[model samples]
Target: MALFKRLAERQRPVLEFTLDGEPASGLLGDTLLTAVLTSGAHLRGSDFSAEPRAGFCLMGACQDCWVRLGDGRRVRACATALEAGQHVLREPGRRP
Candidate 1:
């Protein structure tokens, strides 16, 4: 079961994006972490152990939801909003 679920009967606008080269979508106003988690996707893998991590803290404190943008810039998934046509890489080593 998903931790996050849409409550409204009317669907909100969705933002289309690529997750590790696969097509994905999320509701507008959702943070990157929320989108990924709600989609049942892993946010990232730990750098040291290569174990998958979604996020520890939904806020910006845990530093567990870091992801790379299509341009290769790293950002905290929990702190970043989901944008239309955005692309994200879930693993640490993959670029864009």
Candidate 2:
């Protein structure tokens, strides 16, 4: 039953981005932070475990999803859906 339940779960969406200047791909829909952490990408992004950051509120109530856009702007990853060709920077403060 457990195995069947796992297979019954819908597959996560896919996201394409770069990690440490290297190309990478990952599932979307889930929180960006969770996706990044599971992707095994080498990044210097926000320390979600430290520095007053927390993902307990997955509903975007908290600003913990804040991420640096490739254009040098900050946006919440939870509130923003992943785009096919969108450029993304992992950390909260950084410019691509």
How many clashes in each structure?
Answer: 0, 1
- Residue-by-residue lDDT tens digits, candidate 1, 1-96: 344666663277988898888888889888999888777646787877776677898899988888999999999999999999999888753332
Q: Each candidate's lDDT (Cα)? A: 0.82, 0.52
Query: Model 2: per-residue lDDT, tens digit, 32-91?
Result: 554444444322334643332324455778665666667777767666665654566666
User: TM-scores across all candidates?
Assistant: 0.83, 0.55
TM-score of 2: 0.55
| lDDT: worst 10-residue window of model 2 | 1-10
The positional error of residue 47 in candidate 2, measured at the CA in angstroms, is 8.2
- Predicted structure with the largest TM-score when compared to the true one: 1
Clash list (residue pairs), candidate 1: none
